[model samples]
Target: MILQSLVRLYDELSRQGKVAREGWGTAKVSHRLVLDEAGNLTGIVSARKKVLRGKKEKEIPSDMMVPLMVIRTTGVKANFLCDNSGYFLGVDKKGKPERTKECFEAARVLHHQILDGCHGAEAKAILSYFDRWHVDTARECPLIQENLEDILDGSNFLIQVGNRDATEIPEIRKAWDDYFKSAGEEGNEERGQCLITGKKDEPIAILHPKIKGVQGAQSSGANLVSFNKDKISFCSYGYDGEQGKNAPVSKEAANAYGTALNFLLADRTHAKVMGDTTVVYWSEHAKTVCQDCFLGMMGDDSGLTDKELDDILIHMKNGQSADVSGVTVSPDEPFYILGLAPNGARISVRFFLRNTFGTFIKNIAAHEERLKIVHPPWEKDWIPLWSVVKATANPHSKDSASSPLLAGSLLKAVFLDGRYPEALFQNILRRIFSDHDEPAGGGKPEMFKVSYVKAAMIKAYLLKNCGTKWEGKIQMAVNENCNDISYVLGRLFSVLENIQQSANPDINSTIKDRYFNSACATPAAVFPVLWKLANAHLGKLDQPRAVYFKKKLGLLMDKIAMPDRGTPLPHRLTLDEQGAFVLGYYQETQARYAGKKEDK
Candidate 1:
């Protein structure tokens, strides 16, 4: 299914002139080999430009459409028009003059065979240049000496005739295309029915093109569908000692899927990172509106304000078309989201989702709505997924990343409207317990421990997974009418902590720092001790403030139904009950300062 969808994408993108056609591809060229009308080596020029990468500017090579590069591994294959210094200039840091000379000769023979009969000045100049350029004397040329270091660094170069790139000439392009099409058309024994296209007697690709830009994969790139002949585990019974033949993907189908996937991975605007996985998404029918909408929903670089994003999401959820970034996008377009992870020399599929654009919008809207809660005034109205995942990490640990697999799992739950992974809730609880007592470490004190994103996630989880048990009990804010034993205990504990703070304004540590985790787990043992401490704090307050806090505490305590056997507080709370306890404390604390300006 993945390959079939990619093949269709390749066809659509090809018709839109977005991806390279067969026999052609894009290469990053760092220099250009300039030639005169007489085909003499004239000069060398940088083909790189400064572009912003993150906050820093970098000088990177220019991507040019050239003949497809050969899949080389310890081989002397040469590319047409564009290649590294060893193949084009006969000079490199390989420390093998014999091998370098072989590379240059192969390129010379290829150019002569293709462009010799071409009737264009660009073609003639290219042929003349290769004929006159001798490998032995290449280093002696003044132009080569000036740029020798950069060339020896193995950056790719393109051939330029006079003032134009040789590949841009119409006659030369036709010659290369024709030669490419007929170069390898002879009979082959590996021909079979293609698994992707189901076509009979087609040549199977011995090797698929390398996939680049996958995080943590080889910089040279990695293979998605690869089999090693040397490894018996990868060999099928009938296809021993064969690689791509084992899969039986036609050369054309392989090229189409590889090209399409590479195009999506290379695009920065539509590709995003989810933990260790690299995510790439696309629309089925040659439309970028889906990409725009998805990025906007994720709070990424979608060029849309928060209000604008909310408006589009609303329109889509209502089954209406939305004008996103001035492009009208229907809600019913087919959308695909693929997650790729690095696995040794191969890429692993973390997750793949397909749905109508409107369904995705509705799911995301539901997710956002569930995450809604009464947050601090300074927090953004919409919390991005990255922020939610980060809330579970340890701020003091050096490699404090949440589980690498959790991002994909969480995203899958959101997209499918399924139960969220239990790890998300458990990790949040662990972090809350471990980090709740620590000082803010030079940051704002109010931004400590239980963040708005964390609280909202807990509420969202309980409401979704707990079914009708927590339907009306879990709300966006503190519910005074909620009298669940664990919840009321949590609210009472927060009130006691606040009373301690009010009595002693300059106190270094409140009861929360010392007793929060214990109080949440064993409320019966801790709440009675906290009630005795609250009486002391009430005596320290003025008469008016003392009466006010006492009355509030009495009302909260009365809501907790006393048991006939013993006290109202339970001996211990369950994991789900512990989550409600945390939410109760967070929401009640927020309510205390709801209208006041919080000190940062």
Candidate 2:
């Protein structure tokens, strides 16, 4: 079903001229095989026309549509019509005469294939270039032979004829293109029912193509599906191990879906890398409604101007019903989001979510609302997936990649408005325990406080697991009236820390630096010690300030029951209570700074 939908999208995108043609792929061409109308080799000029110093290489734009990469083997599977100078022009690195000869012969075979299909003026020019060409012992081609040893292995080369690019030459481009579109259909290969299209007598794909640009996968590319005996454990009694026999997918259908998915992955505006998972999304409509706005919501859009982002934020804040660029989103249009993680050569489908565009917006909107805390003004309004995941990663690890499974589960829940992963709760708690409490180090003052993002995440996690009864308690700012013991303790901890700050402004270590984690986890054992410390801090303050804190602490103490003056504090807090503690700490700290400049 996923491949079928992707194939459908491919057809639509091709009809709109949005995706690459069947026989072509994007390439980083660095040299041109300059030729005239008669195929006379012309001077080789550098494709890197502009050079920048203090950088490894110049930044140059790559060509969009070149001949597809060859599926090379020991038998030499050379491209028929369009290829780089190395494959067609016999170019190779220095001191590799055998490789040079092998490639030159491959060029001859490629030239022969092109001639069989095309008989036109430009075709005649191509024949002239290779037919008269002979070996030069001195290695005299100005283009590739000049710097053969230094050329990048995949450095692409293209032909130019009579002041027109080879692609512009009608006969040259069409000849090979026609051959590719018809190549797999000519042979007398056994046919099977296509799993994707259910078409009878269609050839099954021997090997599905590679999916590149997936981080941590093979640089050559990874497979979306595979059935190799050595690599996979599962096998089936099929039509004698024929290609795609167990799970039949026609050659055409496989290519269609593969092509469409690769196009989406290459497009930065359409694809997003979240933690270790790659998320690709699309609308059923030909062109998405406010595509940039849609991308900004799911992925990070660093290109978006602050004003542009603000405009979209305002629209989203209004329930995504506002129009942008005069384009109103049709709420009924279906959208698909596919999350994938790379396994050894195969893709693991993390999540496949299909829903209406309106519903997607709402799910994200709900998540945003949960993250809506009274944060410091300098913090970003747009909290990307990276920041959220990074907070949970261990800071001391060499590779800080988030757990792929956990990240995928969390995102799926956000997209579906379902329950969040339990792992997220545990991971954040681990990070809090690991770093939230420590002595002042390297003579630097402790700035230990609950961050807005972590606090928001805690609220979201609790609401997800515990439901809407927490609605009024978990909010943007402090709730002074609620008397949950954990919440009260958290506020008290912050107040005590503030009193310590007031008493000794230059103190390197505070109670939070020493006792935050213990007080949060086992309040019964720590609060009695903290209350005594608070008394000492209160004594150092002036008369009016000391009186104010004494009364404030007295009232907070009244809320929490003490059978006989600290006789029976709760022994340990549950995870939900811990969340309440974190939120209470954040709200109180934020409350302290809310109206300093505002009142002025």
The top-ranked prediction according to TM-score is: 1
Determine which window of 10 residues in candidate 1 has minimal summed lDDT: 437-446
Write one digit per residue (lDDT tens) for candidate 1, span 298-324.
756677777777787888878998886
Angstrom error at residue 279, model 2: 1.7
lDDT, candidate 2, 1-600, per-residue tens: 799888888888876757766776666666666776576777554454455767665656356466666776665666644465556556555556677667767777676686656666666776778776664542565555666654445466666666666766677767777667677475766578998888998878878888876766787888887677733445566444454666878888888888888888887676777788888888776555444556776546746465664565565545555555576665656788998888988888888888877677667867877777888887876567667787788655898887878888888889899888888887887777676534467875443346766788888887778766576676677888878888888888888888999999999878877898898999989988988888898889999989988988888888887686655668899988988888887788788777555656
For candidate 1, the lDDT comes to 0.86
Best by lDDT: 1
Note the clash tally of each candidate.
0, 0
How well does model 2 score by local distance difference test?
0.73
Q: What is the lDDT of residue 76 in candidate 1?
A: 90
**Candidate 1: segments with Cα more than 4 A from true spot:** 26-178, 184-189, 229-234, 437-447, 598-600
Cα RMSD (angstroms) for every candidate in the order listed: 6.9, 7.1
**lDDT score, candidate 2, position 259:** 83
